[model samples]
Target: MKVSKEQSDANRAALVKAASKLFREKGIDGVGVAEISKEAGLTHGALYAHFPSKSALAAEALALGLELANKKLYGKSADEAPDLDAFLDYYLSTRQRDNLGGHCAMAASASEIGRQDEDVSASFTEGYLEMVRAFENHVAQARPELDSSSRGLALVAALIGGVAMARATQKSNPALSKKVLQGMRELVDEAGGLGKK
Candidate 1:
């Protein structure tokens, strides 16, 4: 039977939602198209109808995942207080570390993305730059006397690296893992407060 336009759009959305979560939980190469379709409660044929190729699906998925992350991390407008404390409290929490699919896409898939095609890499790069710009603006508000752009990049690097390290040591040295998160949070928080009178 021919699917209606509405149903087709719904099915496409479902696939992208499922793809975003699964691809973040598992790297782009970790999960396959068959698994994504199954997770979305659709067949492989339906998945293909929506996306031309797995890479295409993955690129979209990564973008969606990062978009969600950005919304979660930074609010809707530049006027919002950068809430670095809130970000640190949640991001470094054990809950965020445990939920791989719900965390930042970069921390989840940056390594694997480097090996993928240019489309996927480009998607990641674009999301990353957007995040940096947001962070820079926020940092500037918090600390006007310093070079906010450079500091913003450092802050992002610290957050991503801290989360990655925490996740990596989560199973082994849990204490060190917690310290990694706490330490990075402290450093970033201190830096943000540095230039304030």
Candidate 2:
């Protein structure tokens, strides 16, 4: 039977959405095409009809998840920051760390993507750079005195590192996790206050 174009699009979207959340919650290697198809409520055969390979599916899903996150954090354009502090609070929060499936895809899956094929890595790198560039532009606006490029890179690293470390220690040592969040927040606050002085 020939599937309608609408149905085909919906199925592809559902697969990407399910794969995005699952890929974040579990590393790329942790979830397979079968599990993603099952979660998306589509058959394994249906999944193949949409994607040629698991890597292809993963690359698209990663891009979708990162795009969603960038939209949430930075709005429609990279330069617009409706609420910078709010972004910092949510990003560095324990809640965000605990909810890996709903937070930063890079922090969750960068290590796994690093091990994947060139295409997958390139897809992730593109989104990752876009996100960092957004931060760079935001920092340039807020702190004209400082080197925005280096600061943006540092801020992105600290944000991802803080969240990753917090999640890692959330179970073994909750205090350390909290400290990671607090430290990053403090550093961000300091950076924000720099050009004002």
Worst 10 residues of 1 by lDDT: 188-197
Which regions of candidate 2 are displaced past 4 Å? 76-79, 192-197
The per-prediction CA RMSD against the true structure, in angstroms, equals: 2.3, 2.3
The digit string of per-residue lDDT tens for model 1 on 1-197 reads: 89999999999999999999998888889898899999999999999998889999999999998888777767777567555566668777888988998889888987788789899999998888877776687677767988998987887777887888899999999999888987887787788662223
| Candidate 2 C-alpha lDDT tens digits along 143-191 | 7888988888777777787788889889999998899889888887787
RMSD from true fold, candidate 2: 2.3
Prediction 2 global C-alpha lDDT: 0.84
lDDT value, residue 195 of candidate 1 = 23
Off by over 4 Å in 1: 76-79, 194-197
